[model samples]
Structure formats: structure tokens, C-alpha cells
Target chain A: MELAIGIILGCCALGAGICMGIGAIGPGIGEGNAVSKACEAIGRQPESKSAVTSTMIMGCAISETTGIYSLVVAILLIFVAPGLMVNILKEAINLL
Target chain B: MNRNKRLFKLVDILYISMIILPIMIAMVIKILTTPLSQGISISGARIFFSIPFPVQDLIITEAQLNSAFVLISILGVCLFLTHGINSGNLTTRHHIAEWIVEKVQGLVDGNMGEFFKGYAPFVTAILGLSGFSSLLSLCGLFPPTSDINIVAGWAILVFILITYYKLKGGFLNYLKGFTEPIFVMAPLNVLGEIATPVSMAFRHYGNVLSGMVIAVLISSALQGLSSMVLSWLPGFLGEIPFLQIGIPAVLSVYFDVFSGCMQAYIFAMLTMLNISGAFPQEEYEMRKKKKLLKIKNK
Candidate 1:
């Protein structure tokens, strides 16, 4: 039972790590591309720096939502999951 | 003059660093005033007159004040800039501010006018309701927004607006709006008009309250796990002033500056779209032409 619990936790840990990794990719690339595009636009039109800055802020907000979701999942995995607690409680009851 | 220039640059940096500006203010406030430091750890749910609506919480925690003060201060600056310090006269700063305002105004002019106008009544009502959400949260009262009832109210509002507009648009014209030679969709267009606002409200409330829940759960879970783990690591040090006042600051930044602002803007946007789509202006023009046609048919 302990070994099964360990495996379940190990899987959750791996799943969370994978989630963070996959989730970061899309936002990272999208944000980087957005910055580069903004920089290029600003370079071409220095006067429009305000326009570029606002666009960058807006795009970054849209891209960052997925990263927030990943963090939520990671938090759920590490702190809130009850699988291990349930198993241990069952063990104590059986012993009793 | 250069000394004046250097002073301006410093102030500019202070203002631009949005997270720290508030932290510095909060720290000064913390030092000057003794904080109650005591949170009632309210259930975030309460009954009033046998109705299970979440009683608005008047939570006066440092976290809540930090958020509210920073938020209100920023609102003043953004909406009424001259109301505060003239800001650092950092050489080009005035121009930059004016330019920023212009661009944002341009964007608003491009999209928001038609959006806001047609949906004025609904938008006004939601704003009045949710503005109260902020007030209730500030005063240690349970916020109704946390309850499903408040959200259901918004959902019903959207449904009614959509139906009212569609029905008033007349059966044929409204059906035509749904099914035009109009693109690659007929039923999808009809479905989308409905799905948009309701989904928007749910996504927003779900996201906002979910953040609060996560923050609460984090502290609770840590209380449970603190015994097992390296107690040093959850390093709420971010919440501490020394190690990184800025780190914990980012959470509120996300919660308020990002989520709260986005949710407000989206609520306004959805309200506009839902209400406006119902009474599309073209319908009036169409009515005029139909009247002329009827006379000719006569």
C-alpha cells in the first residue's frame, strides 16, 4: 500500500512537471515573438512607442493566462490532492 | 539642471516599477500605523435573513489593504492623473503619458463606443452591482459575487438582453442575422451570440474566485504540510518585507492589476456585445426600407 501510494505521488509529480513545461512553451514563444514584433515596429516608427507598448501589454496578458492555469495545476498536485491522505487514513482504520 | 534631471529619472523609475511603488507606500503605512494583523478567517460564505448568499466580508488584512490602497491609488492616477503628484517631470514623461492616453483612447474609440452605447443600461447595472462587490469585500462583509446567485443574475440578464433584442429585431430580420449568405456559419452564428456572454461571465468569476481560493488553500495546505517538508521553503518570505517585498507583491499584482482589471473590462465588453447585438442599428435602416417597399407594394 505504501509502495502504491509512492507510485501515485510520483506520477502526480511527473504530471505536474510535464504540465508546467508544456504550458510554458506556447506562452514563451508567443511572448517572445510579440516582443520582437513590437521592437521591430517601434524601430520603424519611434513615434509610435506608446502604441507598441500598449499592444505588448495586451498581448502579454492574453499569453500569460495559460501559465497561470499551469501554476494552478501544480498547486493542486503538490498541496491539495487527497489521494495519499486517503490511503493513510484507510491504513489507520484497518489497523484499528 | 542635471541634478533636477537625475531626481526626475529616479521618480520615473519609482513610478514605472508598479509593484514596488505600492510596496514602498504599504511599508510606510505599516510603519506609521499599527495593523490589526488579525484576520477573522471568515468562511467567505454567510447567511443573511435565511438566504445563503455570501455575506460580504469586511476583511481588513494587510493583504486586503495593500490591494485596495494600491488599486485605488492606481485608479486615481490612471483616471485622474493630475489628482496625484504631477509625477516626475522626467524629460519626455509628459509626452509619453499623453501618447499612451491617445493610443488607449484611439482603441476605445475604435471598438468601445458602439459597444458601450447600445448596451448602456445593462452595463450600468452590472457596474453598480460589482462595484458593490468591491465595497463589500473591503468592509469585511461577504461579497455576493462569490455566490452562484450573483452570477446567475448576470446570466439571466444576458439571456434576457439577447432574447429581447432578437425578438424586437423581428422574426425575419433576426433570423436573417443568424443565417445570412453570411460566411461559413448559420446555426453557429446564432449559437455564438448566446454562448459568448454567459461563458465570459462564468470564466471570469471562476477565474477570479479561483485565485482567491488558491491563495487560501496554499496557506492551509502549507499549514498541514509544514510538518513534513523543509519548513524553510514555502518561504512566504515573499510576504516578508526584507527578502522580497516585491515577490509577494506580484501575487496581488496578478490578482488585482491583471485578473480584476481584465475581468472588469471583459464584463463591460460582454455586456456591450450582448445588449448591442440584440438591437443592431442596421435593423432600423432595414425597417425604413421595408416601410418604403410596403408603400410601393400598395
Candidate 2:
């Protein structure tokens, strides 16, 4: 019983770490691509810097939502899920 | 640049304080007096002798209470500033107001076609509220937008509008939209449709909430770090949030100014696209043809 609870908590930790780390990669690359293009545009036309920068930031933000979604899941897994796990285990042990 | 611009800027700063001051007072009141469990209780009037005769203190969550305060304050300022617009000459404030109106109108017209140009006001209001609420966090107010319920409320409004427009286009067509390409994909189609507002609300709420969380955590960490560093010096002097000032201000530029404005713009943009997309394709074509004809005539 102790081993089972320990394993579940360990799995939760692992899942959360993997979720956050992997989830970040897509948004990081997307933001990088957006910023790079924005920089290139500004270099070509400095007058349009405000427009380009604003649009780029908006684009990057939208892209970042996927990462945010992952973070939310990871947060739930790490923080909220443990409580659920303990409750469920309590029920199971009660039945036993 | 000009004297008028500088004076207007000063007035803008003053107006901002006018808005923040009342909200700050409300917040301080909440912080000092609000109970731990039921934070900032406001008594609601007995309704229809509702099940339980005398209702106890209607507990408003700290976040909700603060956001309500922020919203009311914003509404007051909006009303005050916009009140003189109809009567006044094109003063600096008027120019600034007109400039915003023109920009929002242009965005609506350009993105959603001239047919939906009337949506400019709605779009502008949402964008303004979202941006302002997010920025309000800088003033130490719990930004209303950081509340999921607030964004969700806006999203639900947008969802209803989208559905209404879709139904207006054709009820049968709207029904058919749920089963596009194949009947088996109907659930997915419906889900995708529903996901629009859910995603929109969550995206904005998550972004703002994360920023708030990060700011709080960083400040707390800074307090700890400062205390640890100054351990030899002793006492409360070491516990001062010395690292909190300059660093958090720099971080706030990106989190508050950039992300807040960007989210607002994105929300407005998505709202426009979703609404416009609901319109029949014929309207778009007709608008295009009219534009071409006008250009040719010119």
C-alpha cells in the first residue's frame, strides 16, 4: 500500500515535469520565429517598427496559449491531482 | 511633442490616478476589514422570502469583490471622460478619443468587411476593457481580466452573438455546420465551435493569472532572499522587499504592457474573425466587388 501511494505520487511528479518541459518547446520555437521575423521586418523598415512589433507580440501570445494549456495541465497534475489520488486511495483502502 | 500633447499627457496621468484612487481605497478597506473565510462580505437584500428567511452575510470572494470594485471604477471614469465628447471641440482628449475610434473602425472594416463596420464599437469596448483591466494590476488592483469568470462572461456574450448571427444567416445552414464534410465528424465540429469561446476565455485568463502568480512568487522570493542575504545585519531591516522595486517594474513592462495589450488585441481579432466567418460567403464577395467598383470609379 505504501509502495503504491509512493509510486502514484512519483508518477504525478514525472508527468507534470514532462508535461511542462515538452509543452514549452512549441511556443518557444513559435515566439522565436515570430520575433526573428519581426526583427528582420524592423531592420528593413524602421518606420514600421511599432506595427511589426505589436503584431508580432500578438502572434506570439496566441501561440503561447498551447504552452499555457500544458502548464495548466501540469499544474493540475502536480497540485490538484495529488489530493484526488489520496482521496481515491482512502476509499480503496476503506473498501479493503 | 507639442504643448497640447504634453498637457494632454499630464491630464491622462491625473485621470488615471482619479480612476485608481477610489479603487485603491476600496482595496485597502477590503484588505483591512475583510474576514479570512468570507472576505469582503456584502449583504444582499432578501429575495422572495427565499427558502431561508433571513440570509446571512453574502460572502463575496476577495478576487470577485476587488474585480467588481475595479469594474465600477472603470465605468465611472469612462462615463466621466466620454461625457464631454459630444459637446466639446476637437481638444487633445477629443483627438485621442477620435484617433482610437478611427483605428478601431478601420480594424473592423478591414478585417470583417464594411458590412460589419458597426461592430467597431463593440470590438473597441472589449479591447479597451480587457487591456485596461490587465494593466490595472500595475496599480496593485486584482485586474478584473485575471478573473476567469469575467473573461468567461465576455466569451459567453461573444458565443451568443456568433450563434445568433449563424442562426440569422440560416437555421438549417447553422445546423448543417455541426455536421460539415461528414456526419461522423459532427461531434468534433460542434466541439470545435464550442471550444472557440472556451479557448478564448481560458487563453486570456491563464495569461493574466500566470503573470499575477509569477509576480507574487517573485516578490515573495525576493523578500526571502533579501532577508537571507542580510541575516548578519539582523532584524526587520533585512526583511524589507529591497529587490522588489526595480526588477518587478522591468518584468511588468513585458507581462503587463505587452502581454495585456496583445491579449486584448487577439481577443478582439478573434471575436471579429469568428463573427465575420459566420456571415454568408456571398456578403464577402459582394463587399469585394463593391470595393473594386468604387476604386475603378475613383
Best by DockQ: 2
- Estimate the Cα RMSD of every predicted model relative to the unseen true structure: 11.5, 7.8
Please identify model 2 stretches exceeding 4 Å from their true place: A1-10, A38-54, B1-22, B33-59, B86-90, B281-298
**Model 1, span B32-56: residue lDDT tens:** 5543774324243432223234686
First chain TM-score, candidate 2: 0.95
Task: State the weakest 10-residue window (summed lDDT) of model 2 chain B.
Answer: B41-50
Candidate No. with top lDDT = 2
Candidate 1 has what TM-score?
0.49
Give lDDT tens digits, candidate 2, residues B138-173.
Answer: 776667787677889999999999888777645677
TM-score of chain B of 2: 0.77
- Docking quality (DockQ) for each candidate: 0.08, 0.49
Per-residue lDDT for A1-96 in model 1, tens only? 667667767877888789878978887998999999999999999999997986686666556666656755764675556466657767886999
Off by over 4 Å in 1: A1-36, A49-96, B1-128, B131-149, B166-169, B177-191, B217-250, B273-280, B292-298
lDDT of 2 at B161: 92
